[model samples]
Target: MTSKTLSAFLLNQLNELKDRGLYNTIDPLEGPNGPVIRMKGREFVNLSSNNYLGLATDKRLVDAAVEATIRFGVGSGAVRTINGTLALHVELEEKLAAFKGTEAAVAFQSGFNCNMAAISAVMGEGDAILSDELNHASIIDGCRLTKAKVIRYRHSDMDDLRTKAKEARESGAFGKIMAITDGVFSMDGDVAKLPDIAEIAESYDLITYVDDAHGSGVLGGGAGTVKHFGLSDRIDFQIGTLSKAVGAVGGYVAGTREVVDWLKARSRPFLFSTALPPGTVAACIEAIGILQESKQLQDRLWENAAYLRRGLQALGFSTGHTATPITPCMIGDEEKTQRFSARLYEEGVYAKAIVFPTVPKGTGRVRNMPTAEHTTKMLDRALAAYGKAGWELGLIR
Candidate 1:
């Protein structure tokens, strides 16, 4: 096709996205992604961030990042195999292992990369992965890349998992088997049935993988979902992201020393991509230290979530089955969800509307992530705006 024709086609697709209310425009935050963030010269009660423990703007983490950048220069300069493995990387991995109660740990460029690296390294073609239907996109993509037979169980449905697991094993058609689930479903804010999953994995002799990206800083007093279920020593692979709770950019796989060794040697991202910057590594260490020091932040975060949840329910809005600090205010239609999000923005709250392909089509919601730093007063203000928007849109009486 001619360049002009290709350009026209691309533009048409973009227009279609706009018409569908799925074309998201970037709203640049002028300041740190704190409880209240400055955007376009106005401050909004920032509820869209994954900075669960509010470590993104913590002074200790900031200081550590700055110090590391000054001491180690900027980048790692090459991939881990070449000259990229810095002392900070090793230190961070060790720290993560201790935090997760694992024998060893391997760091990757992103949490998505951790899933991509770990899954393909262990389970591949002729293997099977029994995955939760509501797992993160990263987990889904990782499973797809492995060329493994992806058997998806209904979200947290142990019975369905058992049926699939028994079938995969009885057939003797797979070399290796894994059962994967998110510790917390991001869109719905529901905790996964890790206890049930672990039991099922043991019964099927499946390698247990839990991507605790949302759980790392919010659950088990910030140790993660494995610890939340008291299965820290039972789960095989516990995947976590430093970007979300740690307020840094990277991911890690915490498991047996053997798994860590395999990833270091064979994982494509660790082998091919440059290591995480010194600043981020240092910041992650600082963030973990904060979590280790006290449960103050975690407690405050839950308090804020409960307060916000109660306020939303009082306003006659449905919070669909939330079990964590991640709260979703359910709105039925895509356009209505978009309009609700826009109205929230206009009223100075920064939560975004999650639509189709993220969640299911009709279950679109305005996902609110209330952090440790948000005050009850701020939540009250947000609740007022929500009530106003709900009434205006005829969503609540």
Candidate 2:
């Protein structure tokens, strides 16, 4: 039965969130999450999906998933360490390693799980982790899971990282030190300074980990941020997600063969959780192949992003230092940000507002993710809506 005390606490917290305009309402997508999406019987230009290459609805991925499902059934039936490691899983890992230019790779059910598994698997009680101040929530949680001292340095501040690394190393309080960061920060769309990080890691003998979830299939000719900056050989752990630009689902860690072997043997998720389904694995494999085959999709994706970013800037919207396609139209106030998003929705755009906890308070924004599938007409329409919404809310002149 439900406890009254617990229920009351939940109600109070929810009420507070709503009162502050911090409660997010989920919009059920009525169809495939593509360049345009349907919700509540209405279609809108989709500026909210992470489908950078538009491969989520591509025929090749769909066909691959269907064929694999028919051949292997719906599930893997057991954890990977048990009897669930299918041939498809092996093939996918090999493809991922080659794509990331690493000696080996290991797959997880999701990008979140990859961090949860990999961090705890390698680092333990006596170790310390030097993390970026603005790293993703998954990385933060993963660090928490391990019994390590987590030192947060300034975001992308190489000097701060160097200082912290030196202090951690000199203190002799930890057995090992790992410097982890997001290759491409999803919120602000800025790329991490991997070259500087690699240099620091080498000087301090720190293990380097880059969670390139938002970088794969978008940068480095689709190889990712590590490779984009020519540091693939320098970074120790190269993590990426298949759900974003790859247009499938799952996460992977590409590193030396020894590290991959260690993770396969020790990562908790691989040891305890059921393996990713064969269909999803097969789809991911196909997506990687698609990305490897050409740079056409990546080119189109960048072109669209550039067009949208230019339009927003021209419209007087402040797009924070975005080096990639994840464009955020900054709106400062939480309620005003939510209202701006609602206004956009009313005008046939589906850009979502990112509020507190996702970003720091007072930094709320409407993040626009323009994909390769978005045409000029669609983007122009979205810009028009942004202008109208901004004017209505007195956000711009």
The candidate that wins on TM-score is 2
lDDT of 2 by residue, 17-132 (tens): 99999999999999999998999999999999999999999999999999999999999999998899999999999999998999999999999999999999999999999999
lDDT (C-alpha, whole model) for all candidates = 0.92, 0.95
**lDDT over C-alpha atoms for residue 70 of model 2:** 100
Q: Which portions of model 2 show Cα errors greater than 4 Å? A: none
Per-residue lDDT over 301-377 for candidate 1, one digit per residue giving the tens place of the 0 to 100 score: 99999999999999999999999999999997999999999999999998899998688889899999999999888
TM-score of 2: 0.99
Q: List where candidate 1 sits over 4 angstroms from the true fold.
A: none
TM, every model: 0.98, 0.99
